[model samples]
Target: MTAMSTVPWLTILGLIPLVGALFVAFVPGSAETAKRMALGFSLVTLVIGIIAATQFDVSSSAQFQLGEQHSWIPQFGVSYALGVDGIALVLILMALVLTPICLLAAWHDVPEEVGPRGGQRAKTYFALLLVLETFMVGVFAATDVFLFYVFFEAMLIPVYFLIGRFGGARRQYAAMKFLLFSLAGGLVMLVAVIALYLQGPGGTDGFLIERLTGLSIDPTTERLLFVGFFLAFAVKAPMVPFHTWLPDAATESTPATATLLVGVLDKVGTFGMIRFCLQLFPEASQWATPVVVVLAVISVIYGALLAIGQTDMMRLISYTSVSHFGFIVLGIFAFTSVGQGGSTLYMVNHGFSTAALFLFAAMLVRRHNSNSKRIGDYGGWQRVTPALAGIFLVAGLSGLALPGLSSFVSEFLVLVGSFSTQPVATVIATSGIILAALYILLMFNRVMTGPKPEELVAEGVTVDEGWRKSSGGTTVRDLTTRDKLVAAPLIAAFVVLGFLPNIALNFINPAVDKTLSYVQQAIPSLNPAGTAAEGSSK
Candidate 1:
């Protein structure tokens, strides 16, 4: 075993964003000032996140690096701790990269009325955003279970304010609903955590995750406890029946906020499953595999069907995320190392792909000057706005898991890994691929083809007091330089990661394999594949 140092730099990195948020809130003059401060802070965090990523020892398998541990609440055996292996580290970095992009997008994306409201509100919003970032990073890095739980619960505050204050017509309703649901989940999880703590190796002590994983519990208790945790995660993952809040929340919130909500925040749920359900309650996860796999399969098909019927672009993307999450959950419960690793990678890939699509859609909505994102609203857009169409096409293709796109590799790995333990579910889930193609292609055809609408072709059309014109005096305008700058990194990442996934896989596989080994050790009979990988070298 490598003797890793216990230094919680990652937690410190998370805190930097909160500090930035405070700075923005207290020293703001105008909305633009507040926005700039937020952006600058996010960028600083990004730089720190990059430094942390660079320090990561990629060759290590499952052992956390740059780990820091110290006592926080000695009475309850809770401690301040943080670290990450490959999967968590990658996700954290992805969140860091996207946060700045979202801030930039929000510079003009948020409605003026819902914006800063001058000094105080603008400061508060930025403060909330910064706080949200801190919690998100903390959740990924925390090595202590109690610390993870605290961060997990703490994350909802900023998101609540973000959606409630700056969302669409139904901002208040949607924000409240988002808060209530997540809080309910968190409360349930809190009880489960407390129960686990009380029954830990030494009663009323040790909430360190690694230490607790060594404690023994019977199958029944384990399964029950797993459900407590799983219910919380399922709601957060917004899996199927528990997903009602997602469509409305995404539809009503500003695009930039939705990007964080969907891209990074939702990931916390899936991340928890990997950390808690599989690692700490391995036997229970094995026992509950069938139920989880079935639900995951249903979410896949159901989310796609619902997405096809949606008129709101934001809502449609939200449903697509529900579907994508299904695939991730399926991979997790399949119990193969490949499946687990693929699930982890898919989580990262989906974050990027969805962020690109949502941001582009925001641009479209801005250009059109209408709340309606109906496919029929525009036509022959490719001829008028080639850049917009091109970016949309790239994003759509990525969503459908097109060959050489990043999603394709992760989706393929997930399906392959899932095939062994869940052949029936895997086969059914594979149909989601076809459905994905149909919906994505249909969206493209509706938006990019056919005759250009007469109204859209009119130049200098008055929109909310501003004169707006489509490109070439006969069609919609092409993507501006700013749009190109925003989208270039996203598209390039999709291509680079798509072709050479080894960059991510090198970091992910070891941790995934380690997790699988832990699960199998706890439930030897469930090793259906009979592979002798328990002792295999990474």
Candidate 2:
């Protein structure tokens, strides 16, 4: 076996942001200085993440690479251990990439040193983003179950403040709801974590996932623990009934915050389903699949339906995420290698697509006369801000899993993977595609391409009279250079991943196979499509 990299690359990747957060918070500087510092740190973190990715050997059978283990609390059997499979690595990299984009996109989100208190708030905002990056990286990288839980719950601190302080009018209400839901979920998972730990072999290495894996957990006990973990993930995934907090949170928070929250943090839910729920309690996972699949299907359809009913663009985008998450969770529990791999890939694709959507939508909203978020507030924007409209359409198309975009391949794999053992549920879930088209196209048509509203348009506007003058007599602007910089990489990712998904899938598929083998989900009756891959164990 190739010895694990000794430099603790994962820890460094996480702590670099931690150091950056502290620096940004304590140092006296203008908001511009803070923003630039934050961007530089996030970019460095991305570079490190990419370096770590290069070290990952795709053909190796190692379950985790670039491992780091250190005993932190010997008496209690808790230690600080970090590692990543292909799945966690991709997620960590995704978060890293999004962090810098969010920073740039939010350059003026908090406004630059406007009031006496503005500079301070701005510094705190960017610092909090850095802090959130640390937690996000840690949450995905931690191999110790206790460490994972710590990072898991710790993420709330930065996110809570980001929403409560920097968000819109109902920021406090949204932040509180989000906290309450996450706390409720975390509390349940804590009990399960404790229970699962106690059930494992007690030693100095006690809380490591390695120790917990394949433990002889009793069937009833296992099911209870699975419920605890799955419930937490479901809430995080914000599936159906528990999803009420998301729209408020998304709508109230800054667009960059919304992008990270929905795009990256929320992914922890589905990520947990794979990393903990299935691997730790295989029998329970199989046992719960039937019902979970039903709930996932409901989330898929219900979320899309709710999105269609939304007039608020941010709220609409938020609902679409709930719907997208449904597809992710559906792919996870579907039990086929392709389904699970697709689910992981979907997480990454969705992050970039949603980031572009939220950021672009925010740009458009900020430019509106009243800065209104209402879909009814604008029309024929394509005739004025064609560049912004163009990227927005790309984002919206990706959301609907349009044929030429990135989401199509992942969504297709999910459906194909689920169809064998879950034909009925898969067919029912497919209806979400039509609903998606309805929401995305309708949203585009209403907000982007149709006849202009009087308030949103200059008095003498016509279709060909593009670049219409606003009420202030200034011609409406398209995308600025900064906007294009943000748009280019995201659009490139979509195009590249769409036609050449193997870029990610090469590693993701092997990880999926390992997970399936470990969970023994390759049993012929349950997942015939993956039976051929049964022997490909980690």
Candidate 3:
């Protein structure tokens, strides 16, 4: 075994945001100061994440890097164990990168007097966002099942408050639905966790992933345990039937909040599937692949079809995520190295792409007075807000997997890889690309092009409503300096990753190979010869 690195970078990465959240909460400051402080802390965390990435040994055979372990509950075999592989590292970086962008985008989002807190609401809002960042880091970096579960469940609180308190008109309903669905999934997972503990060697080693993976469990027990974990993950992934809560939650929350919710938090589901399901119950994972793949295909077509029908811009973006997640799940369950690697990269790419779309959409709403989320509310926006339209167009193109964008590379790899294993399903899922184009272009055409609305013309263009109340006049502005600052990085990420995916794939492929190795070990019949042959032909 490689000796654990002495520097606790992962701990520092997780703690910085947490500490910042505390400081923001108790320290007295104006909303602008609070926003600046949060952005500073998040950027510092991003630097730490990049440093950790640089330090990571990409070529190592070790499954996890940057490991740190400490005893937490000796009797129950729980420990404060933290580590990341290439896959987790990428997702953690995604979370770190998006946090500051979200803060910058939301600089003026919260009203001065919201709920009972009035002037203090901004402080509370930024604090909650930072606190959520801590859980996001912890969830991805955690090596112990117990620790992961704790971070997993703890994540909902901050998001719930973000939606219920700071969101749109139906925020309370959306928050409660999100909470209930998530809690139910957690409870199901709790049962599996306890059962796995009992099935393992007794005492303090029971909850350790290294120890549990070594246990020889019966197939029946493994399958049941897999269901418990899979159910939770599927809900979190918000796949098809279990995904009803997401559209509401995404639509109701502010775009910055929605960005984090869909872009970062939801990745936890697919992440858990890879970490827990495939790693811990390899046989069960193989057994469930057939049914899961079907559901994934359904999610692709279903989500895309629904997205095309949405009039509300926020809800439309939310539906698109459901479709994209389906691709991630499809790639994972396909059990090929390329498939899994593509899925992992897709998680990172999706975060940036979705962040751009959500944040830009929010900016559009704000420019339109933040009073109307409907696509019909604005027209010929491209004529006046060309900068906004250009970025929005790039984001939309990325969402639909335009060539030379990050999403296209990942989506292409996923389809090619999955085709080697499940050709029929892969072919069916191809139609989703067409549907994606339809929804994204259709939404873009409706909101960004055509003629300017008569309302803006008749009202004399000086907007006095919503966030634009101080703007003084009816001329809709283009992307502001701050907006470009938030947008530029996301656009750069799409371009860089699109062209040089090896930057990520070099790290991701080894971890994916390790995962597929375990799957083959559990089910020797699932050898990669078939996938290899298919790839060679291509």
Best by lDDT: 3
**Model 3 residue 16 CA deviation in Å:** 0.7
- lDDT (Cα atoms) of all candidates against the true structure: 0.81, 0.87, 0.88
User: Rank by TM-score, descending?
Assistant: 3, 2, 1
**Candidate 3, 68-89: lDDT as tens digits:** 8888999889988888888998
lDDT, candidate 1, at 437: 86
| Candidate closest to the true structure, highest TM-score | 3
* Alpha carbon deviation, residue 131, candidate 2 (Å): 0.5
- Model 3: lDDT equals 0.88
Poorest 10 consecutive residues of model 3 by lDDT? Answer: 457-466
Clashes of 3: 4
Q: Which scores better on lDDT, 1 or 3?
A: 3
What are the models' TM-scores?
Answer: 0.93, 0.95, 0.95
lDDT of 3 at 114: 50
Better of 1 and 2 by TM-score: 2
Residue-by-residue lDDT tens digits, candidate 2, 1-538: 1236867899899889889988888788777787888899999999988988998988888788888888999888888988888899889988998899899888878855566566888889999999999999999988889999999999999999999999999999999999999999999999999999899998987999878888887899999999999999988987988899999999999999999999999999999999999889988998999889888999999999999999999999999998888888888888888788889999999999999889999988877766789998788888767778889999999989999899999899889877877889899999999999999999999988876544443333332212344555535557666677778889998999999988888878877877777787323355454456522531
Model 2 alpha-carbon miss at residue 504, Å: 0.5
Residue pairs with backbone overlap in model 1? 6-67, 6-68, 7-67, 7-68, 25-123, 471-476, 471-477
